[model samples]
Target: MKLAKHIKSALAIAAIGAASSAQALVVDGVTWNPNALNDFSATDAMYESIVSNIGDVVSGYSLVTQLNGTASAVFCPGCELTMTFTGYQLANVTLMADLVTPDQYFFTGGTINIYVDSTPDADFTDPTTYGDGILFLSLAAHTMGNGYTLISSPTPQVGNTGNGTGYLDVVGGSAASNFNTNKYGFAYTGNTAADFLFTSQFQLITNDDGDPVCLSSVNDSPICMQGANTINGNSIPEPMPLALVALGLFGLGLQRRLRRD
Candidate 1:
């Protein structure tokens, strides 16, 4: 009996070590992360269109939920709001851009669209349909490394202007996030059905290698990455705050010690 228990412990340790190995998913020649493991729960997906043939789910992962920076965390109904996030990698992907050279850099990105409804009872359970929520905020983001975290400060969702359908316009950031790039946020003009970013973390994780999956053999191929993710759910300000960080903020001897989960 003791021998069997010792064997299990040894196996568990070996598994952990193996998973720690630096590994990512790839398809053909593109290294794209897959949300297959999480059962296709990518709220917003990113892709690189090299002139054409743009795949929506370029191995997408995770969902989104923002928090209000307040003590009571009350829902003001029509108060102005701002958003900030320490992003994370729900899945890993691989893709070589056409302009990417030996030492050149490339990009893969996603989007977040918002809506406003004065109904007072807005429901966003369905990001696609937004159950009861109306379109109000819409923004796009891009990343260069495995994951991204916005600057420690909060900005408004006024990027590119002439639009207010979406927000979280993080077009550029880095891996370690040791530098404050051109990361800015947006805000609602008069405020009403819109405020800071909403909700708790939720998502589905999957492999990105375009392998067999939960509903494979049905014709189409689903590509996902190997990793865990959050269940994407949008919401208004609740009483209690949600802390969805995994490994805490990366604290190296560098720039802003932003959250790296």
Candidate 2:
């Protein structure tokens, strides 16, 4: 009876751990550190565009410039550029961008259009969709026409920052842009802590002229750049999936101890 009780206790603890692990799906990739400003801006820091042609699971990692910042902050019509992120999964998708220096750098503002495999409410369970799956943005004191616009701070969404984070219709224009190379994409955390799986930190200007800058030579366009990325789901080994490991270990240990007894 004592051995049976011990085994049952271990099994119960294992089950609980498994349940907690379900909180999020894990994704494997080069851990992008926001604090590593210099490394984050380097060409090697951006998420590599995963081509769908291959048997790759996740889709393309692309960027669309909705509007090219002008001498002022007004977005000129017909100046927006859109880049489709192919093979995009509905799970937690985190997009990141950064600028360096302020010379020739103008106010960079824009909307990021996100097309998920599932609906907003279905994918991210949240009272407000603002951060759940969509986000709006704006930044002040943003100078335009500069070579690099360094991110000294993490600016949240705002009215004039751009437009509201609305549902992206399959046919209509899904995103807008105010700044060219300073915008980014991330999951909404206002809902639940589980929704925070795909969060990204910001790194300020690290190197001077050596700063990593993503730029659009044409002013309004997705800046073509190369970088390495490894995306793994919670099913993979990571903090998000640690519960599964603990449960397995506990179960195995319980079995061994019972056999010995």
Which candidate number would show the highest lDDT if scored against the true structure?
2
Candidate 2 lDDT over 51-73, as tens digits, reads 11212222113222211112111
- Candidate 1: misplaced stretches above 4 Å? 1-66, 69-73, 78-107, 120-135, 143-261
Writing each residue's lDDT as its tens digit, candidate 1 over 160-233 gives 11101122332322211211222222223112211122212112222376332331111122321112222222
Candidate 1 TM-score versus the reference: 0.25
lDDT of 1: 0.25
Candidate maximizing TM-score: 1
Worst 10 residues of 2 by lDDT: 160-169
Find the number of clashing residue pairs for candidate 2: 41
lDDT of 2 at 55: 28
Native-structure RMSD, model 1: 21.6
